[model samples]
Target: MASRVVRGGHALTEYLNAAKAAEPLYGDIQKHVLEAALRPSGRRQDVLHPSEMVKPDWCHLAAFHRLRLEVEPAEKRRTTFTRENIFQEGHETHTKWQRWLTEMGRLAGDWHCAVCDGYFWHDTTPAHCHECGAPSRCLTYAEVPLNAHPLRIGGTADGYSPQDAALIEIKTLGLGSLRYERPEYLERYTVPTDVGPVPDLTRLWRDFRRPLPSAVRQTQLYMYLASHFEDLPVDRTIFLYDFKSTQETKSFVVTYDESFSGPLIEAAAAIVDCVATDIAPRCNINSGSGCPSCLEFEEQK
Candidate 1:
């Protein structure tokens, strides 16, 4: 764990420029990421392993090392981007994200918070002051200190390092890009008439659900943790969108409280129950054309 010290102060703009120049090296990591992407929803252990990544789905295996996988149904696969192409295009935002962090390594001096316009002692992000709560960060550096922290992820002890993470988001637990609710045929068939038309929830989510269900669960868990054991100050996550690249990133916000216990596992059980009862076995995937929505409905013809 080495400290990133910038001379006199870090010239944020300069390092940012240099990182832009070094984009290709970052692009190479996308291949490894694509490996993770294709196999959505797995235990983090094998997914993050170096040997498992040897037979990369694409050449030379390069791209940011980590990403939330975006799985699409095999039937719906229409994108022509090679594994490399898609990952590279998709991973563009991640590259920028890492570069932003690497520049922090070059950070040098004390800076002011634009939001509260005051100084705080704690490192890392959320840039808030313990004294006065102000939601300010991603600060403009004036010889700032780039407090680099390791990304502690769940489902595995191993993940990208701080240096490598300066090139990636750190940890992500996600399945296919489009989260589906497997259709419920038995329930619809067994039940009688007007219990309200069992709606097609799929059509409702035609657009990308940019927000993660993980976040929702995180929110609920934080609520439970705060109520039961300690008062944890949960910060709402934010999205950073790039109009130029048409890329977007869900910014990382990590926090903890005085009661330095391990992550709350209790929240996971509730989430699993909800998924099993409400989401799993529910199907939303359907033909957008005027055709009948369900394969079952079409088959009974």
Candidate 2:
């Protein structure tokens, strides 16, 4: 039997609920943010691939990406008048963020492509396409239909390089000591029942023990399929940094195999089909969390 500590309505449960509720709203925010980021280019005719088109469930992921880029120099200091800066404030808290981004941009200047299209390097070498003149295009998103499932699988990858023929997934971590826990760690951690007060380390450890939480892992899997099926050599890397101590953690790398892509695509298609058919998808949050738009609809019912 599952332990009481592993029961539903635990902190993990609440966290998943909040994540679910934020999904649609985050998608909206992402659409706005990405549009803002791309607006200065004035490339209206630059068509979005099916996966690149923002979906109703993409808000959270988009917000995270926006926050990450907003802290990068090329994006932060590009120009206050740019669409990326439309909602940014020049306040004290943001000032440091802006400065950090600027400094990082300077340090990373040589790594960027001269073509100015939006491709960035994930390796020590610069990303360039000899045949295309454009720095390798990363498949930011892709929409593909799977036969096993009736719905279209919408997916977004971190980055891709046609030059090197590589697919890269980027993960960022903010200031903290790093430790990789095994699956057994889930059995060791306990979820507290009382809500009065929680220890910081306990909370962190509990969070660490939580699995990839099905939905998030599935999304990543979908992204993998979207990029890998196109014949890109897939890779994953983590960028771990400690904000408080300004220390860097380990940068781990992994390569993906093509055999995994087809199954993931099928899974993504199944998920999309479930969503389209009004069937409650087997996600962390079946009822949809506190997304304001979703909430309004719920209230009406």
Candidate 3:
């Protein structure tokens, strides 16, 4: 049988409707859970990551815990950070987009031409060094293997400090989805519609609810990637929760505390140690589960 997947603001509602028509028992269960979830505090506490609890180390080994995080489906979404938040229909191109980003950095950026200390402001758009005639470079993007969760881990190492990155991804979960479901929470939001230089477009945030499991998992995976690069700056790991919904987009910045990297580093190291020593601690109660990731040490003993 072919697997089926459906999504939208009314996806769950439609899903439950199908269930009610076909399987009343399971359908009622879904209704019960969803109704509770829609309550003021109906969230499932277990799903939320605890600040004190570091996730199981993701060694990407044959180990299951590590593998699950690596293999899990990620939200399919896309986001763009443009300087112009301005646009013209059928007028924008990636080159133009990059140029706009470069232009916006004129005053804020402390970078100078490598060969000659010329100002980028006066140079031609997509400026070349006036003194030495060198070209300006835009940020590079590299694709990651997780298609269920397409992500690009790219960063730049300028002279000032270590490398920093803009965590870009195809985001399917809108920012409005993560917010509380208040009466006024369902307001229309402004979104950019153009990726090229053609023109900027706008859309409304309709029917978007809490994030999908895949999207949040992808966010965590992005954080894990940050641990891979010990030199990755804290500011680089931060992401703008910009997920597009039918015709419109919802956006907000989701920045993490720089200190959070410490936990990720330690978790990464622990996973590495497990792999180096060939040990798989029980991930949960070992009731013939063949795992090692949970349970107190005494419980295991």
lDDT of 2: 0.34
Which segments of candidate 3 are over 4 A away from where they belong? Answer: 1-140, 143-170, 174-232, 236-245, 258-264, 284-287, 291-301
lDDT tens digits by residue: candidate 1, 107-224: 2223446666676433243344444565544343322122101221122111122322111122231222222322333233233348764433233233333444343333333333
**Any idea what lDDT model 1 has?**
0.31
Tens digit per residue, CA lDDT, model 3, 190-239:
32456632211232334444344334444454445444443233333222
User: Model 3 — which ten-residue stretch has the worst lDDT?
Assistant: 81-90
TM-score of 3: 0.33
Q: Candidates' TM-scores?
A: 0.25, 0.33, 0.33
Q: Rate residue 234 of model 2 by lDDT.
A: 36
The list of candidate 1 runs beyond 4 A from truth reads 1-84, 101-234, 242-264, 267-301
